[model samples]
Target: MTLYPRPDVALICGVDEVGRGPLIGAVVTAAVILDPTQPIAGLTDSKKLSEKRRVELAEQIKQQALCWALGRAEPHEIDQLNILHATMLAMRRAVAALRIRPEWVLVDGNRTTDFGIPASAVVKGDLLVPEISAASILAKVARDSEMQALHLAHPQFGFDSHKGYPTAAHLAAIAEHGVLVQHRRSFKPVRQVLEQGGL
Candidate 1:
């Protein structure tokens, strides 16, 4: 709680990722440098908030934060580099794209990536840190919007509802309709379907 404006550091960025478990689309990440002067209320892990609230907060964060940037690792990159490494790559890209350079970074989760700056990994940071919470909201909102777009393109997959997760309906869709380029080929369900010549 209250992990910003350290006695020594001024600009601190929060980092978080979304969509690591999804079967389709990219792993998206967000880096946020909150404007401590403009404190945001109702900040928490994105999963804890309603989609409507997350969308509202995402817009507020984008407008109020000192700087923020989004990054993503595509499905092809996820297959080539694996989810863990691809997530780290996405985190790095999010930070690198920031308009304002952060003096220190606080990333949610147990692991931290090399952002060429001082950084620490705060477990459950999205709950404890406002910055990370903002990042989580932004990342989730962005990725969910993508899933909605994918739904428009491939309505049979029900992407709008499942957001490309390995739900029973999604697996059934893959089984019946075959995998789209958006599906991560390395994922077990997709791989199983492909190996069985389901495609």
Candidate 2:
């Protein structure tokens, strides 16, 4: 790991999003400015960690990070703006909601909006950057919790297990129950179901 001298740099928040590929629910993002004095061990991309580990790290991040905030684009927003634009909207909101304004924004993916702040896009940032990793964990855990809640409301969709991804089980559920209000109408699978006259 290389040394990052914070003295010369402006406050920076690492940003990342989850649920872009999901068939239902909102796209969630998080921006985190980690406290340099309170370094967290074992931070990595949320997808690389176990669910239990991600949950543990998420709590630690919330407690120890200098500032953190979550933002989201609801299903209707995704349908209206398309996934890519909706994701950028969520990222912008995450930055705006931060307690401390970041002089620089480091986003996980290779593309992002200006957000009226200086921003740089990093490929695979969630894996290479600690701040991005923390953001990834927070975003993932929050979205997963939302999926669990949706599961409670519609256990037939198996949201708790598949998290609204287009798994065989999930597709079958859509075939049986039809698309729910939360389903992304612009997504191919859901659109196909709707085209077929639905359930």
Root-mean-square deviation (CA) per prediction: 1.4, 1.8
Per-candidate TM equals: 0.97, 0.96
1-199 per-residue lDDT for model 2 (tens digits)? 3323333465878999999999999999999999989999999989999999999999999999999999999999999999999999999999999989888888998887988888778888888878899999999999999999999999988899999999999999999999999999999999999999994
The model with the greatest TM-score is 1
Q: Which candidate has the highest lDDT of all?
A: 1
The lDDT for every candidate, in the order shown, is 0.94, 0.92
Query: Can you list the residue pairs that collide in candidate 1?
Result: none
> Model 2 Cα displacement at 183 (Å)?
0.4
Give me the overall lDDT of model 1: 0.94
